[model samples]
Target chain A: MSELRTAGANPPWDGLDGSDRHAACMVAARDGDRTALDVLVTELTPLVWHVARGNGLDRSTAEDVVQTVWLALLRHLDRLVEPRALVGWLVTTTRREAQRSWRTNRGQVPLSVELTEQLPTEDWLPEDEALRDDRDRRLWTAFSRLNHRCQEILRLTVLAGRAEYRAVAEALSMPRGSIGPTRGRCLSQLRELLNAEGGSR
Target chain B: MNDIDPRDDDRGHEDAAVLTDLGRLVHELDPPPVGLVERIQFAIALEHLDVEVARWERAGSFAGVRGDRPGTITFTVDNLTVMVNFTSTGERHRIDGWLVPAGQHTVEVRVADHNSTTTRADDGGRFVLSDVPAGTTQILVHLVNSQGEPGRTVVTPTIML
Candidate 1:
């Protein structure tokens, strides 16, 4: 499917090009083409890894979560309905796995910015601090501290970009119509937390 | 006091910040494990071979099929007494190898993971306890056709005697 190479030389995302190619590879993977699945894993691993770390999972836990996601996909490939929704499915699954890992571990390490450094950074561009200022970090910290229900709600809405009421309902087990108002309330609560922490920063 | 709408266009700057941080964080997140793609693909191919075998077997059409399975292949050496099992279409399922006399003779076998090699057969597939070379342990045979594609699901988990 894919050639063996060093991460420094041939990064996982070297050839994603755009979202369309990403979508194409997903379709090919579902069709049982190893070559296509190779490209799909290579291109999408970054995003899945990111989602795991972003959700407060530590490096090792996040790594396990990622591997489990791939293995789970191996066993459940035939269950995927819409090929185009592969990204959404992967994102949702990664988040769930990451959360589960962190929760099960309980008192070990918490998710922090350090989790982001587990991978090499040769391909990464510098971050703009104006964008990732103290406020952002605080929001992330608060996000990490949120109750599981709110965390899941915000995750489905703000993070993975799933706007369909039905999908959000399915993911969070809320009524289909409750998604909009619930999302608004969650964001407002997040804003309150962000604003309260602003003075100290 | 001031208020900001999370979804307003003017907050493109804030959105840009979140995206930038998220992108950087994502970029730094570890890639999938090394050799993962190959391992997964190998597994998927193996699964497909199994499905194909089950279908053929169910349809009663796998009588003489050969080289459709993916795995290491094992067989007797240099024994024309080898009986060939044929599919209804009359094809050989197991390839014949020339059984050589004792001491140390190489019996050719194919490994399903895209590798091929030979093992020493004491008296063909007869010697119950012959020691194979260190690197030439028992091979789980899955014969591929001339095109090098998996052909049949013969004996799975086959070990060279």
Candidate 2:
């Protein structure tokens, strides 16, 4: 089955970017629409998990951190200043929680630098049984060869889907205008790495 | 709102193809674990949500736990803290927990909104919640004031038992 949901078919709400999606959901949620909240959680959990995992947390730990972020969001919903900033809010919050989990795992009492900390290298998407195909494995290896910033930018762009550059900027402190350039550079670098490795047709 | 124009990105079709491939590969590598949506659904059903969030700590857990292992976790909010012990009881879980500093409070183990069970912590802060369905559950510790109005409420991170 093709996994391209909302790819060519622009639904009435499909044109909305990441934050806009969250904003629309938030509106429904504030009106006591329980289903809307479920939509928000189901759609956004992948993004939150990616943010936490990209910080180099192991699978279980990343799951725990993402759970914490959702719980915290529940407690702070009314206090949210900008409902439209939900993607940015989730990104920033998930990162901080991931960092806290990272620190606690290392027995640190205080959280380190917010944005620039290097997490202990972890097998995030460890070789899973589902990825036994040779080409998929090679693609994983090739993708891993990119620097941290490139990997993050690519994943963030995918999560943001049609590019809410502002939400992307909030997730990783990049200049909004530079996201396109960075994405281009990173994709080229990934392509070169794959070619040099002679893997992935 | 600044929107993205793939056309304005000035990218060759090859780059777009690569992004598509990468997205498919990553999604296949590790999709969000099943039951994640159900778990979040249970987590957000706070009747009174303006309560303090008790950040969680994996105080203790058994390694390689699968079928019938006991596990414990701790969550803290302000000076208040709660620790829950889970013993797998077939398809359900028996939850025994305690409050820090030993105070009298009401502890509620709620699965969804209707299947809620409440217990009172004793003077020594011990409480037991039984027969909770082995699914996503949120535990709330509420201290009520003189007029029976809730004063301080501490909640655990949504936990899968």
Candidate 3:
């Protein structure tokens, strides 16, 4: 897990911090830098994925929503005035698109189940055969036990990283000041759940 | 900095550690479908920025039965609609396309990693593009105004063949 902390230690955008790197990429992408645009797409896609999946969309629908969001971004590339707001823009757009897709899909599949109940199964990738370890399973079980809001917050904060907290807060429609505390409380709760699971085992 | 509570700092550190682990776990458990980024990059790598992007209306056949039967897909943008019926032709593919509100417009089949094929549609809005080497593909309809001059272009979302 510690090795994961160094995963992006040497980002391509030198000198700039995480959020600033995204901002710089956005500016470059808007200016028609293909490389920068690729960077932006690769970097923020995880956050977008979480947002879409968090909204209770099945895998295929989530994939379509993700594609639609990126295409929408390209259509409005020049119109995005604030490069710093890129994450928020993407998050908000993904949420809206996911909701739309969810409503559309509801026509085909009867969705009487709660959104949280659908999360674990609908969002689970079939290729996650590697998630076999006991600790990972325990962690995932604890994570699934969380209410939808906490899960959404935790996933977004983790993927978006600490630097883009403001954008994430705005996207989630929470007061900017409360994001940190809420995230802290969520992490604490997850830890408690993990401890409980471990004790019962 | 010294006035900051050490307990708060420790808590923050613990939260950071938990987040790092959680991030890794989430990514391992359910990452984006493979090559999604590449697919998007291919889709948005348009030659013209001012074109209207067409939304995929419906696909007629299952991908598994592609070569066995002619697969049809329709894309629409505003009043204009483009539908393509494609079939695997041995080593290549054949595409029969129709554009509604028929006119003699230029239709280009953009294939990734291959030279794009361009052909003009008949006044009835029917066109054919043959020998298209299959990979990822999109369609571009160059509208011609009443004066036979070029108008706004309509681009379709990328589809894998």
Best by DockQ: 2
Q: What is the lDDT of residue B55 in candidate 2?
A: 73
Fnat of all models, as shown: 0.10, 0.42, 0.31
Top candidate, metric TM-score: 2
Ranking by lDDT: 3, 2, 1
Task: For each candidate, give its TM-score against the true structure.
Answer: 0.42, 0.79, 0.72
Tell me the spans in candidate 3 whose CA falls farther than 4 Å from its real position: A1-14, A105-129, A141-151, A162-174, A177-201, B1-20, B57-70, B78-80, B100-104, B145-149
lDDT of 2 by residue, B52-156 (tens): 777777532322232356877777777987888888888888889988877778998877544788999888889987777876678889986546676877776
* lDDT (10s digit) by residue, model 3, range A118-188: 44432343343567777777777777667555677778866555453434534443444665566566677
Winner by TM-score between candidate 2 and candidate 1:
2
**Per-residue lDDT tens digits of candidate 3, residues B1-161?**
11111134457666666667777888777778887777777777877666676766533212322234567877777889898988898757899999998999999998889998999999899999877888778788999997999998888767777
lDDT of 2 at B97: 92
Ranking by DockQ: 2, 3, 1
Candidate 3: the clashing residue pairs are none
Which candidate comes out best when scored by lDDT? 3
Considering only chain B, report the TM-score of each candidate against the true chain B: 0.26, 0.76, 0.78
The TM-score between candidate 3 and the true structure equals: 0.72
Total clashes for model 1: 20
Clashing pairs in 2: none
